[model samples]
Target: MGQQTVNEPPVVEGPATQEFAPEVEKLINTVAKFTVLVSQKLPDDVAARLKELAEEETAPMAKMIYSTMARNQDLAWQLKRPSCQDTGLVQLFVRAGTDFPYLDRVDAAMKEAVARATKWSPLRLNTVETFDEYNTGTNTGSRSPWIYWQTIPDSDSLELDVYLAGGGCSLPGQGKTLMPGEGYEAAVKFVLDVMTSYGINACPPLLVGVGIGSSIDAAAYMSKAALMRPVGSHSANPKAAELETELKDAIDRIGLGPQGLGGQHSVMGVNIENSARHPSVLSVAVNTGCWSHRRGTIRIASDLSYELLTHKGVEL
Candidate 1:
């Protein structure tokens, strides 16, 4: 009989067996590094708005404060350090496709990246057990790194948004349930009240996020969703978009301008996210972003290649 040659089976890459390439892994690490970097450097648009406010600000103290903020932002970027010592807690909003090769391991990779970042970038250890009051030091523990996941169908890539929520900015987060009859006007009033009182404290030229729906929790979650919006973006619905614009103008008139010292700009913009509510109840929630708004986004392909979305043209 002729000698039979044996052929090795073809290699297959599955979710369990696939590994991210060296460059891809490096990209993930780079994201963590950039997260720390951007947290220190306010966006150009934000900085420009602050400058305008400083020029137009009538309050001497507020003008001086705005000038100091602008200077501090410049220095923080030049020094490549965190603008705020708190650095806040890290939150990741991930939209992953079921077919993405690294979907299963993305969470692990993120946790690892965060830990590496803590050591390399020196991010503050903000994760403390509520009851125990013990800091994790590494910023990675049970739910210490907040992640929100959404699965998309028939997609081959994953999109990740990183948000750093500071204590002061998050402190003004408020939500309430109202009777359906209260309608949108009531919701608007609630937001106005919050901004008039706590908005100054949140560091004006704030990005206001409003959520409207049923249930206090749902409204609150929607409000946070609003914060994910781009500075100048508006709602899809015409009415909602109009409300956003109106609120923005009203806030600017508040003169809470940069760092709450008072200026021409009280808010950078306003965004609203709404959902269908129960017949009997309507809920509204609000959250604010400080002047030093820190957020970044990246999208990864099925092959583990990625793109940075938040800071335009940023590679890795």
Candidate 2:
């Protein structure tokens, strides 16, 4: 899948596409292409981890499911289509250098890129307005193609972390707050409970992201953000890293297996991201990425030259 290539350049041709300057237009084209790539191809890390998990399975049923997954990816690459039917609602986590020239245009360009990708990659129309109850049909609506922004000091590049949050994976997402006295064990229990009750629905062998903070909102954001990290990555803090390993072991012991059919392992890995909480309260949230966790990262220089960090050897 990594070696698969699309030679034809993606062209964005709406009334809005011509509004951008040459530089911003190039940015839009590059981002649009990368968005398509992210939907169709698993990142190198995810692909490698899937192979590792498949090797560890001893059950014939689990083994067969893994083989099916491998074939699914091959077909996705060969057909030049999304690996999963739910291409998911696009989410971009942007780290823009303070000096980056196109920062002002980044937001609009990102929306344009997603709109273009919807037609080109043929992404499913996943954006629906609340209460209004209608699909936007462009994979975009009010505040759709969600963007989370950060500022980078003394740099001249924009780094984009792309994620496809599908409905099945999003269904299990939850958050909770515990009094100081509850301690961290309660947080651990919260994670285990969520997994055992809802994990299978997301298709087992999940990539779990846990976030600890003082409020549900903060923890929820961090939890989803944690999914942007590569599978098998550990937190920099030693204790947090230990928690990752512990939770991974505990969840694997659940034996949900591939596609939740029951087998040797329940998760690809567990990742924890935390922020110092208020002394009075502790909040923890959980987010899961299904076996086909579609995510990627790209770095674009001020000149618009780019690097596909997560998908090495693949070009936009």
Instruction: Find the candidate with the highest lDDT and give its number.
Output: 2
Candidate 2 per-residue lDDT over residues 68-108, each given as its tens digit: 99999989988999999989899999999999999899998
Q: lDDT tens digits, residues 1-316, model 1? A: 9995544323433223336667557646765775675677665455655566567777777777777887888788778778888788888888888888777777766776776677666788887766555566677667757888899999978887778888889988999898768888898889999999899777667889999988898888888878887778889999999999999988888777667766678887889999987889999999998877877777777766666666665453
Task: State each model's CA lDDT, in order.
Answer: 0.77, 0.91
- What CA RMSD would candidate 2 show? 7.5
lDDT of 1: 0.77
Candidate 2 local distance difference test against the native = 0.91
Runs in model 2 deviating more than 4 A are 1-18
